[model samples]
Target chain A: MTIKHGGNIYEVAKKYGISEGEIIDFSANINPLGIPNKLKATIISNIEALKNYPDPDYKDLVTAIAKYNNIDEDFVIPGNGATEIIFKIVEAIKPKKSLLLAPTFLEYERALKNVQSDVIYYLLNESNGFNIDKNDLLEKLEDDIDLVVLCNPNNPTGQIIEKDTLVEILIECKNKGISLMIDEAFIEFVDKEEEHSLIRCLADFDNLFIIRALTKFFAIPGLRIGYGLLSNKNIKKRIINKKEPWTINGFAAICGDVLFEDYEYIKKSKEFFRVERENMYSELKKLRGLKVFKPHANYIFFKVLEENIDLKDRLICRKILIRKCDNYVNLSNSFYRVAIKDKESNAELIKAIREVLYED
Target chain B: MTIKHGGNIYEVAKKYGISEGEIIDFSANINPLGIPNKLKATIISNIEALKNYPDPDYKDLVTAIAKYNNIDEDFVIPGNGATEIIFKIVEAIKPKKSLLLAPTFLEYERALKNVQSDVIYYLLNESNGFNIDKNDLLEKLEDDIDLVVLCNPNNPTGQIIEKDTLVEILIECKNKGISLMIDEAFIEFVDKEEEHSLIRCLADFDNLFIIRALTKFFAIPGLRIGYGLLSNKNIKKRIINKKEPWTINGFAAICGDVLFEDYEYIKKSKEFFRVERENMYSELKKLRGLKVFKPHANYIFFKVLEENIDLKDRLICRKILIRKCDNYVNLSNSFYRVAIKDKESNAELIKAIREVLYED
Candidate 1:
């Protein structure tokens, strides 16, 4: 009955009898530069919005999202978060059989299950550094698969599917009359995102569905804002028409307009991650009992090599929280994912890992 | 494919070329007091929570809600809003056949449709002030009906089902092995709510499911928080095991603790509605071209007497927004509903209606 994945800080805090505010968590991948000051001030000054029923049509937010992604406003359907969008799209399509990647986001499976769709997984091999090879995937995207889901810069691994590879898959799926949903939730954190994103192909590929979130990079997960982009007019209409009113809260609606266009926050975030992700990856790689993988996003995924220590338990004793990847399909107890945080916190995690691994 | 619902302020504002902030909206029912000052302060101070994911299990929020409602903590499941809970319950149970009140909240139909459930309605008679006849509804709950939904102090009509009627239905449903869900979302605005609410019946009836919302009563619809109370352990486990993590945000999580105990706001809101609902209802009753029903909640429902006039269009011209009831199953363009607002706003609505109805 335990359905929880990550970010259960209150449970972790209470079980350990520590204050939630005191725990330094790297369990969930979020923007390292905290909340944007401009967005914070906007939320505080416009606190009155909580009283109003959010616009059911969500016109302005949709317009803003459409403009940001260079898509038609009619093709955009914003949700409470990317999670809701995933569920809605799955419900609307009602695919007979769905194909998902192993060690992917859990919500995709949950969403498909809601529609009673039979699901099969394309296992990503750990030996290949967990990266998806396009030709291998396209071979599997036969006519029998009604839908295919691919997460860019995949979670728990921080591995990116190459741009040309994605285009090939999209073209093949289109030829086979299959729907392709690409979850680009962490794309903004990847260096040179334009090379890895499917936003450019959206105008040409009606079979593609791209989900983008303002939660992570904009640092407003508590506000719950995300949107989907597609070129298929009929599919977009079906999804939007079936949605519940006010799925995007008024605060989140306001956030989409302001944060999506907040270029200053964007610039600052990219610079911080570009420098910090590398620094954290390098520092962790120096440890004797750990293997740090090359990360393309804000989080680094690593595996413990030594047989004597329980890495997740040792880190928990030190009041450090990192995601244990055991729950992910094909991932074992030795795998862990940590968000690349500020210099001080990175130092703390490094020191704790060294102390736990080297202690005689 | 047009969805009949409210809370799309962004779309309406753009359609009419009006700034959303300028429109006096009555289309969606919400508390007039806006976000609590303390909650606002909490959100601003805890803005950094946006940098981290919300606690997946929502323990603190659930504990606070349990304390507020005087129930066991395990009996509740808090959600993004009441809508999220409603969808989850339907999916989990996968009811064989369901019963709904016609012209009630529209989301029930959409949720049922997602699961492909057979839906039948017990339409409320307008001649009877839209009241539910317990005897008639009981007879309709035949052998095949797995679930029955009741919106107490029902939306759009503002009609309250008697306490004894709910008790009789609850007993009947339990005896017949059927689950009954009573949505008390707007119950706080109704006088003698404790008498009509099934909140206390959870221990006695395993088939009872009560849905409550912090959105309307606390005036934080933008925060998106609500919960479900049920005594059935099996159903509870199913919902908990299938839901998306962190559906409720951090500020909303804290809000369950703050607003539930905010005695001042509760007192002020109750007092304001006690006086204002009566005045607004009386004024509408006096109108020359409308038949206004007695309102037990913070909203009044009415029918246009004159066939030549479009009340929704006229009200829109006066910069006032009211929900058109034509979207509801049994309702038509002749029906409309408006909220009981502050004294000044109430007067403004009354004056506009008089001019539109009686003026040459």
Candidate 2:
């Protein structure tokens, strides 16, 4: 009966009798730069907006998002979060059977279940650093699977599907009448995002759906805003027809104008991550009991060696929380994931892990 | 397909070239005392919380809600808003043929449609002031219908069902294997919410599902928080299993503690509304070309005289927006609904209407 996702800091804080702010949370992969200052100032000054309901149409927000992505306004459907769009897409598609990568974002499976849609998995071998081999994925798509969800810069592993591989899969899926939904929720953190993203191909592929989130890169998970971009008119209509008005809060609607256009924040974030991710990744790799996967995004996925430690509990004991990968369909308890935090925090995490793993 | 809900003051303000703060919005029936000061202060101080993800489990929020409602924590499932709960409940139940009150909150039908469920209506009669007729409803609750939704103090028309009628319906539904859902969203504004609410009956009726919202009562719609209450363990499990984690935002989760426990705000709001509603109802009743329905909640529903004016267009000219009930099933363009606002605003609304109907 426990909620099945990350970012339960309140519960974690209570269990350890610590302030929520005191915990270094890696359970959720949110941007470490925090809310953009401009966005913060806008929200603070416009706190009274909470008194009114959000625009039911969300025209301004949609237009802002469309302009940012250089897409048609009709292609966007903003939601409570990327998760809401995911759930709605599944409901709208009504696929009899869907295919997903093993150990991907846990929510796609939950969304599939909500529609009572059966799921088929294309397991990514742990030895391959959890990368989706395109040939294997295309073969798994076969014919009858109508929906395929790919978590690009995939959660937990932070391993993304390469451009050539993604293009092949998209072409194959289109030929077979299968819808390919790419969750690019963490894409902004990935270096050379333009190279891996299918966003540019959305206009050419009616069967492709792209999910984006402001909660992560914009560092406003508390505001609850995300959207789906797709070219399928029928599916778009079905989603809009099913959506609840004002699902995106008023404060969140203003966020696109503030965060997306905040060039300084974006540039600073990229620069910080360019240096910090490698630092954190190498530091974790240096640890004796863990195998850190090569990360493409802002988080590193690593496995605890069976011989050395209960990594999750060890980290929790130090008042730092990380996501245990056991709940993921294909992963075991030995695997864990942590966000590649800033320099000082990364050092603290490395220090904590060393203390926990190296001690007698 | 424009989303058919009101209180989009931000967008309305933008279109009308008015600041959102200047608009006297009577579209949403939120507490007329405006945002609770304590809740406002809490949000301003915890502005930094937007940097973090909301508690995925919403443990503290749930506990506060349980305490407020005097129910077991397990029986409640919080949502992004009451709308999300409605959407989730329909998906969880996967009802084959559902019966919804015509002229009720629009989301009920939309949610049912998302599941591709067949929806039938028990149309409320104009002669009855849109109140639920228990015998008529009981007759419509055939064994074939898996679900029935009632908006007590029903939207568009603020008529409430008495406790005895609701109890009889609940017991009958249980006997007939029908799931009865009561949306008590506006019940808090009623003189005796406890007496009229099926929340007490929740302990006894496994067949009953009660939907409640903190938005209208607490005046925090922008935060997007609401909860569903049901004693049926099976239904509760189904909902929990299907929910998107972190659906409620951090600011919203904190609201369960701040607003639910703020006795001073609650007392002052109720007092203000008790006087304002009576005054507004009397004023509207006296006005020509409008027939006012008796209101049990924080809004008034009335029909414009056919020969005199188009109320919606007239109100729009005055920069006032009221919900045109035409979009609601069983309601027509001649019908409109308005919120019971604060004393000064209520008087302003009355004067504007008088000028439109009499002087113009």
Candidate 3:
């Protein structure tokens, strides 16, 4: 079978001979609160804005992002999504040798390959709960490396590197003349995100780059809005020079202002996840044949201990979909990841898993 | 002065110290009929779709484009806009030497420059009304050139190369192992577009590539949907492999099936443009010091015969925006382009120009 990303309900529905709306998707880590009411109202009111072209410079959108992050306007560059910005950065840097985490997001590898950059992997050990070992990681950041990527509250595993440790790595990368990129796509879901984010360090470290997206936290993955931050003047200039204009659509461009200001939605989602993530993790840990990793974001990662268990397939049979992490490097078929949904859905998933595992 | 492209109403509004809604935009060549009513209704009804991630494969959108064009599904690839596809194709082909027309759509050059490809221009002569000379163009197709880009019913100048001449160029490109990319972005606005389009010849010419967009014809530039077509399996495979998933927002993805099926909107737009374009051209020709190039698209290109006339600024003073061709290569301050809008707006533009030129 081909490696697949989550949120692919079209293919999954066909495979299971079921309607898409019937399948409960725990594969993608989107906020359970869903699209904000204010955003929906904004879309309806400004529907006519679709007739005109989006601002080529996307000034309003960038201003909103800069204000939200409390960063300089020069540091913000909005894109079609985090994916486009990743490719643009790789193209601009044209790094000779780059280092990435073994079980990280797949697009980093694909973006680097597009620019013909030689990539080396620093494998995160499963024994350490998929967390990077500071000393081991430092050893891999040799003078020969030109770029290094970190995914904070990393996908699939949902583990975050401590702030001080990340700072040490950043200083080491700067000493070695290597650029460090931290993808904080899921950072907003982490408790005290401002403390964990490296965005503040950007002013002092010219070598640091940070990527953020509204897809996961804002619960609007369908809108496709993401931005990147960097204090390096030369690299930022190169990216802007190479970028295609108006990559963000009108509706997506308008989203940064309204969605980020949605305090009620933000507070409610964080509050829900704060309790639900723990409950979901504890329940899954009760099952005798599974080991659930402590989750820092809106998803949990786990390993099936029973040798012959096909947990993903079993859950899918009950109209539930969980991400099979076998495709990730350094991971085997027994590993899986699932999003922490709302109370009712999480309970339903837990019930289904218990029934499937205990029946045989 | 910084180089500017049309449809930058945001920047123009700021520069003129006026609101965006107050400015009459004749700079962008969008359909005067505005956003199709059906599209507006669909967007309102499907507002909740924004919570879900766009299909990574975009299978349904691609299928709709293929069906609309009467081509095989394998030949289609949807993008954020034509701009994204242009950059992707440049990256995939990695052309050593590319040939482009002078004073064409500027994004093509930017896309090629991003890949560090060597670009050679075939300057369109003003003596020939900015249209390519068949024999002269044929001679420039050197065997060493790897790629050739053409914009049919071209931007700014609004002149199209004859169908027979385009076919000849395609044959030569194929024979010399060069890729031919024809941008049919404005082809839908042309009468009998089927007779002039190279899309149907894809089965016979594997080296041919065509780019199209709904931004202009559907009056939805804010939505940002465009696509590319080619029968070359190898190139298509490379593009898909290198493409970042979900570049299209969910709303834009759903637009393919809805907008393409709006027959009433399509027929009315064609009928509207067929009359308005001629009226605008004839009215502009009545001025004493201007030479209008007969338009084949929704915009008309003209030259100010008299010196020291800042037509763009003068129109701006009247709260009307027209594109200045000074930034385009092989063109000067005397040249300008304006869109054929609704009858009232077109007449207002004509009145503004008359007062600025003859009355002054």
Could you tell me how far off, in angstroms, the CA of residue A291 lies in candidate 1 after the best superposition?
A: 2.0
Which tens-of-lDDT digit does each residue in B36-58 have in candidate 2? 88888998898888888777777
Could you give candidate 3's per-residue lDDT for residues B1-360 as a string of tens digits? Answer: 023789999988999998999999999999989999999999999988888888888888999999999889989999988888888888788898999999899888888887788999999989988999999999999999999999998987999888999999999999999999999999999988988999878999998989999999999999989999999898888998888888899998887879999999999999988888888889999987889999999999999987789999989988999999988888988999999999999999999998988898
Whichever of 2 and 3 has more DockQ, that candidate is 3
- Taking the candidates in order, what DockQ does each have? 0.59, 0.63, 0.67
What ordering of candidates by TM-score runs from best to worst? Answer: 3, 1, 2
lDDT: which is higher, 1 or 3? 3
Measured with C-alpha atoms, the lDDT of residue A123 in candidate 2 is: 90
Comparing 1 and 2 by DockQ, which wins? 2
Off by over 4 Å in 3: A1-3, B1-3
What is the clash count for each candidate, in the order shown?
7, 0, 0
* Ten residues in sequence with the least summed lDDT for candidate 1 chain A: A1-10
- Look at candidate 1 and tell me the lDDT of residue A10: 72
Q: What is the interface RMSD, in angstroms, for predicted model 1?
A: 2.4
Q: Point out the higher-scoring one by lDDT: 1 or 2.
A: 2
